[model samples]
Target: MALPPRPTPNLGWSLEEPRNEGNSLSVVERRMLERGKKEHSETTLATTRALQIAEQCQEMASSTLIEVQRQGHALDKVEHGLDAVEQDVKEAGRLIKFMRRWCCFQILCCCDCFDPDASMDKSRQRRVRMRAQEEAAMAEGQREFHLAQQAAVLRMANKGTDSAYNGNDAKARSELFAANIRRKTSSREGEALPGLGYGLPDDDQHELQRETQLQDANIDRIGTTVENLRLMSLDLQGELESQAPQVDRLGDRTHVVHDNLTVLAKSARRV
Candidate 1:
């Protein structure tokens, strides 16, 4: 019973152990940790948004690159087609030129079966004939001119001869008249003149010499005129001969050219 009363007394004065304050977090520290976790969650959301925008830009760039490639291919095809068409046009032009040249060559060579007189167009044939005639006329005119010149030379010589003959005839007449007067005087005076002898009168001798010279000159002029006329005739003949062949050849060539031109025109029309 005494022990129990002692224990009750100690209960009121209870000896409790010493309490130590250790290094431990408080309510304020716990609040700071919660705020930091909220900030981290916001930063993560922002990073996710930035990554999404970058991916969208990359997709657009890829699509644009593909479209550019397609456009480039189309342009290349167009250029190639143009090049091929140009080459075809060039070949066509070359063929046309070749055909034209061939036709010209045929014309120049006078291809067969084409009659200048019948097959050729009338106007062209007429022109060719007219050209030939003109050449002939020119040759004739040249011959006539030469002949006229020769005739003029002959006329000049003849005129000179005639003048000489007339002069000589007058001198002869004077001499005869003087001799007759002297004879009559000698007979009337019943005396002969000393100088009066049986000789030709000076006028008669001069007349005879002049007549001979005039005759010779006239003969020479006639011979020269004849020779010149002969030469002129030869020249005219030669000209005719030379020009005739040329005219014929030119006519044939012209006909051939007309035929070839006709054929070429038809060909061009077809093309």
Candidate 2:
């Protein structure tokens, strides 16, 4: 009777059986966990695929940048060649001009020796004027040829400008594509997956997000590089355009010197 009375005073004692919660899970919870694992695996797989694609894009961009640089170098070589041609033309013009002046002086001396008091007849003077007019016309033609060459160079420069614009547009598109990928990744990160407790570990998810962020940074760097290359192309095109007129002038002067030599040769033969 005393023992029964003591048991009646134990108010904190539990009557229900203990459950093995640590060793067993409900069927629904197990299925939910399985589903969460499946979804997480799929998400991880998709993220990996996206990363692979991003890497591929980066590689492609790198190769494209290399090609653009090569083209720029080729253009630089062409510009140097043009400079050489211009220099050679100038030297040729100077030599021709000097030869023409020397020939004219010799022809005058010969004429003075042959006919000291003989004045030029009207026909001879008219022919001389006509020959001078012809020389002027030849110089004009030479100028026109030089202008045509300048125009051709301008056209080429315009084409290069257009190509640069196209590259810019492509770069914009690439940036937009990178932005969309980042947006999608960020949105996915914000979403709370169902039964996340049974899904990928928090550390794993954070690592994946870090990798995605790194990829995004790489893409941004690539876009910046492409933009810089495009700017360089534009600058080169502008430089080409600016220099075209000077080259044209040099060409015109060369042709005029050549014409003067031809006229001097004819006058020398006549004398």
Candidate 3:
């Protein structure tokens, strides 16, 4: 079956790539564009994963509510299941964030490639920056949810609410507890859930935090890289401008010199 067309992003950009100058995109611009398209799709896929996870959470909540209404039987299982749901949610959130940053980066590249207007590009860049901020906010929110889930999981484990959901390998145990819920939801889920931050200890929860810091450091390097690349692009343009005259002179000299050398060799042979 034919698929529906994807809607254009509301980037206020309808300007086609400058193909009239050459082909669809210059080499550098083409790379940037491909990165943008690639990252955008990944972002969309990550977002879909997140949504599916959210729905999983909702279903878990609903089932727990139903169980509560019944007789509070197996409440421990429901709590363990909720912790598992929380873990899955955190995993989805991390992917959403990781993809968002790359998505923002690629959007900037796309804006630069397709738009000659500096003002427009700057506006778009600013928007992407804000999007990055939103991603950061989301990371913070996920941290809170994880902390809550961690506390609940710990409380339940200490009370021996669910021995099957605890141990030195709490992550694996919790995952085992959550597995049934995942199976129930999988048929209704859109795509594969993102796999990240699995089996992290409470002390090791800082892994994603450290990664975020490193990414921030990398963002600082982007400014330096862009300045250098801009200078190189300008240098290339200048070199191309002067190259025409130098190439003409050199080509004329080499051709005449080669012919003269050939003639001189012939004369030498005759002599």
Candidate 4:
């Protein structure tokens, strides 16, 4: 075989096949490969760890936001509820206050209706009225007695007195004049003037005049009673009217107080 190509130097010759230059690794190359492999592994591990940490952080943040939102919503609900409650409370208070005012006004009205001062006036008036009545009765009796005296005097004058006696007539006339003067005085003092104008013996008519004076006195007393009663009743009515509005105002104030209290309560609840 023509020397078999002079024995190809057996470059691949050792029995285990010479380590190929291409296949054999140098120490530096091996070290470089190992370093590269180690770096790659570290980079992958770092990437994975970083991704996991980022995911964990995102989850924590999301949970935190959810909690915050939930709390905010709860707070909003509470605030809204409080506002409504406050309004209700305020309204209730206002109503109660109004009711209180009404009650006070009613009480004041009652007081005005039955004022004790008015009662006092009434009691005094009653006593005065009684006195007036008694005086009127006394005057009436006096008048009746005087009328009887006058009739008797007239009849006696007609039967017993001797005419033709100027002196006797004059004495009788003087006496009659004195009696007439007394009658006039009684009439001026509001006594009932007897029917003095009726034609009758002057001597007999004095008693009649006196009776008329008594009637006049009774009339005067009745007039006074009427006037006084009228004035007193009018004054009582005026006073009652004047005080009535005060009672109503007090009731209104009480109602206002209740309304204010209700509003304050509601405000507090809202807070």
Candidate 5:
């Protein structure tokens, strides 16, 4: 009562034989051929993956280059705008300084020409002018009186041929008129000329002379101050002009350094 057939041992087949190898190679050759084919497939896949990664790196670098170029152009435009703004500001400063200097010059002219208390000074000058006119009129009156006396003498001489009494009356009349003229002149001479104001300005002539001299001095001082301001403003303009190129160069160097750093970063990524 035993089993009819026991299981057969696979003794004829070589160890580790892959399926469908019997038609092409011996046992050892089939094993080596399978390993070689697998290695070739793995190498091909690795090469394809490497090619794709290289293409990706190239695209990234190209895009980065375009972006860096665009940024560089933008930076240059920004620097140009800044330069233009600085120039505008400098010009405006120069114009303001010029206007201020012109105003200062005008003020100096005003100080030289106009008095602060013009009304009071004008009143004093008017009084002085009136006094001068009065004196001139009085002198003219004296001359007229002298002429009248001479005319009276001539009349008396002409009338002497007619009567001595008439000549005497004419002489008396001439003497009386001369006496009246002398009395009026003496009275006016004794009276003091009235003056106005507090102290120095009481004499309008002296005050006018002093004010003219003071005005001249003040004008000179103000002109000197305006000249100094102009010089300082010009100096600042020259400094700004001289430094403008250096500032632009510094900005360019900054962009150049950024570009160099970007190139180095790209190279590192490739490594």
Candidate 6:
């Protein structure tokens, strides 16, 4: 006899249930994958922007360095001009000294006279002493002026050195900033997905870094050369100030010597 007919399997319900479940699972997975892709794209864009910013900073730094160098050159020219002024001053001093000595010598020789009386002898000796004293005073004034000039020079030199050190520090900081940017870019590229071409090749990157380091070294050597020039100008100004007193003293001494010599001449003529 035929077995009782098996209840018709609920194949439709079973197949429909499984299909619905699979579709739901697939939709969730697709959404998750899309979200991941979007995040990755955003990350890549951000990295690119960062690279651009880094490059801009590098350009700015380069321009700053150039400006600093230009300033340094200008300072050098100023220093040269000051040097010329100093030479002129020195020449003037020599000429003045020569003229004074020559005039004094002539006056002394003209006033010289042989005197047999004791009073005349004493007067002649006094004239000689006064001449010696005048010469010594002139020499002392010259020495004082020289010393003042030297001191001023030393102070200016120190100031220039300090300014140079400050410039070097600024240059070093810029170089370091650039180096850090390069390092970060390299690391970011390494972390990025393959084939994204997010950063420079290893060789190019290394070359860039090397070039940056070289620039850094060059900048360090640059120091604030202009600072030295400024210092030189200050030194010259101080030198002039110091000379003023010496000049006044020399003038007063010359006047006193002239008066004494005039009196001696009258005495010799009378005798």
The lDDT leader among the candidates is 2
Worst ten-residue run, lDDT, model 3? 68-77
Better of 1 and 2 by TM-score: 2
lDDT of 4 by residue, 1-271 (tens): 3554545475754544334264454556546545754564465555555545544444453344334333433443444444444444545544454444455666575654644343443355465567557656665665564444334333323322222212236535544554454456555865433554344445334544544444454444333333323323343354346446645655565576567666676754643
lDDT of 2 by residue, 71-149 (tens): 4444444444454445444444444544554566655755544542233321444645675576566656655644443
- Identify the superior model by lDDT, candidate 3 or candidate 5: 5
Tally clashes: model 6: 0
What are the models' TM-scores?
0.30, 0.37, 0.21, 0.30, 0.29, 0.32
Alpha-carbon RMSD, candidate 4: 63.1
| Candidate 2 overall lDDT versus native | 0.49
Tens digits of lDDT, candidate 1, 1-271 = 3554433454454354333244233345435544654554455555455545544443443344334333433443443444344444444444565555556655655533443332333344465567557656665665565454344334322332222222235533543454454445434443333343224345433444444444343344344333333333443354456555655665565565556556655667765
| C-alpha local distance difference test of each model | 0.44, 0.49, 0.44, 0.46, 0.45, 0.45
> What global local distance difference test value does model 1 have?
0.44
List where candidate 1 sits over 4 angstroms from the true fold: 1-24, 99-270
Off by over 4 Å in 6: 1-28, 99-271
| lDDT by residue (tens digit), candidate 3, 1-271 | 9999998789865565444353544556657655754564465555555545544444454334333322222332343344444444444444444444445656575554543443433455465567557656665665564444444343432232232332335534544444444444444343322343234333323444343333333333333233323323343354346545655655565565556556555544543
lDDT of candidate 3?
0.44
**Candidate closest to the true structure, highest TM-score:** 2
For 41-118, candidate 6 gives per-residue lDDT tens digits of 565555555545544444454344334433433443444434344444444444444444455655565343432242
Candidate 2 is scored at a TM of: 0.37
lDDT, candidate 4, at 218 = 46
